[model samples]
Target: GYLGCQDTYYVGNFKGIGKVYSQVFIDSYTRVADAKLYTDKTALTAADMLNDRVLPWYETQGIPILRILTDRGSEYKGNIEHHAFELFLSIEGIEHTTTKAYSPQTNGMCERFNKTMKQEFFDTAMRKKIYTDLDDLQLDLDIWLEHFNNERPHSGKYCYGKTPMQTFKDSKKLAVEKNNEILYLDYISDSQNLTDNQVQNL
Candidate 1:
C-alpha cells in the first residue's frame, strides 16, 4: 500500500499555509510502513524513494514483493523515472501496475491507509503544534508508525476478534491448501488428457 501527503497544508492562520510533501510505502503482508519527507513531487524523487527507502526496508525484512500497485500520478509515469522503476521491478521479476485514471477506488487500500495516517498522525501533530521542521515531523511520523503497526487494531476481525496479523496468517494457511488442491486437479486433468492421447495413437 502507498500513502502520500499532498504538498499543501492549511495552518491555523486564515491567510497562511505551509507546503510539505511526504510519501510512504506500506507492506500489505506485514503492515509495516516506511515514510520519507520530500521537497518536491518529481519523478526523480519518487524513484529515489522506491530505491533508497522502500526496497531496502523490504529487503531487511526478507519480504519478497511480487507486485507494486500505484495510481497514474505524473511522478510515477511517462518519464525516465518510469523506466527506472520498471528496470528495478524487472531485476526482481516483480510486476508493476497502475490504477485506472480518475479511479481512486482501484487503489483503495493505499488511499484508505493514507486517510488513516492523516487522521491519526497529522491531525495529532497539528493539534499539539509539534512539527517545527521536516526532521521533527519525520520523528513524530516514526513514533506514529510504531503505534500503528504494533498497537492499532485494524478494522476487520477474525476468529475471537483476532487482529489483522492473526487473521492474515490464518488466511495464508487456507490459501496454501486451496492452491495445492487446484494444482493437484490440474495435474490430474493433464494426465488424463495424456492417457487419452496415447490410446488414440494405439
Candidate 2:
C-alpha cells in the first residue's frame, strides 16, 4: 500500500500571485516519494499525474504495489478520475481504499511525510526565497528528496537511530517475524478448534 497527499500553493507577493498545485505519492513500503507540480488540481490532471508519472516511477523501481490508500479528496474521488483510477488498479490487481472522512490518523504515514516535506523543503526554501519558477522548485524538491531518503534520520521510536531507508528495511524484517509468530499461533488455535469439533462430533 501507498499514501498520497495533494495541496496547493501560491507564488509572488500580495499584489500578484499564481497558484500552483502539487500532489505527492509516498511508498509506504520503501518511503520513496513522487511529487508533481501543476497549474490545476482537477481530476483530469490528478489522473494524468498518477498514470504518467507515479505509476511509471513505481514500475521502474520494481515495486509491486498491492493497494493505494488516500483520503476522501474531491480530486481523487471525482467520478471520472475515481473510475479511471479504479480501473487502473483493477488491471494491476491492486485495491484502493479511502480513509474515513476527517480521520487523519488513518492516513498518518502520508500526513507525516507531508509535514516533513513542508518543514524541510517548502518552509525553508520559501523563507529564503529560493524558488522563482517551477524548475527551481523541482530542483529543490529533488535535492530535498535525496536528503530525505538518504541522509535525514527519521524522528520516531520505531526508527531507532536509523534513517528512513534503514528503518523501512528493519521494519519489514520485524513485520515478517511478527507475521510468522502470528501464523504459528493461528495454526495452533485452528488445530485445537479442529480437535474440539471432532470430540463434539464423537
Among the numbered candidates, top lDDT falls to: 2
Over the stretch 1-202, how does candidate 1's per-residue lDDT look in tens digits?
2222211122232112246666666555444456676656666666677777777754553444557776677666565434655556566666677788888577666666677778888877878774557677778888887777656666632424444445445555554565467668989999999999999999
Candidate 2 lowest-lDDT run of ten: 8-17
lDDT of 2 at 50: 72
Query: Highest TM-score, which number?
Result: 2
True-structure RMSD for candidate 2: 7.2
Tens digit per residue, CA lDDT, model 2, 1-202:
3333333233223212256666777666556566667666665565676787777765664444556776777665645334655556566666678788888578777777777777778777777764447766777777888788777876655565567667665666555566567668989999999999999999
The lDDT values for all models are: 0.60, 0.64
Give per-residue lDDT, candidate 1, residue 173. 56
Model 2, C-alpha of 97: deviation from truth (Å): 0.2
Q: What's the true lDDT of residue 151 in model 1?
A: 66
TM-score of each: 0.65, 0.67
Positional deviation of residue 24's Cα in model 1 after best superposition, in angstroms: 2.2
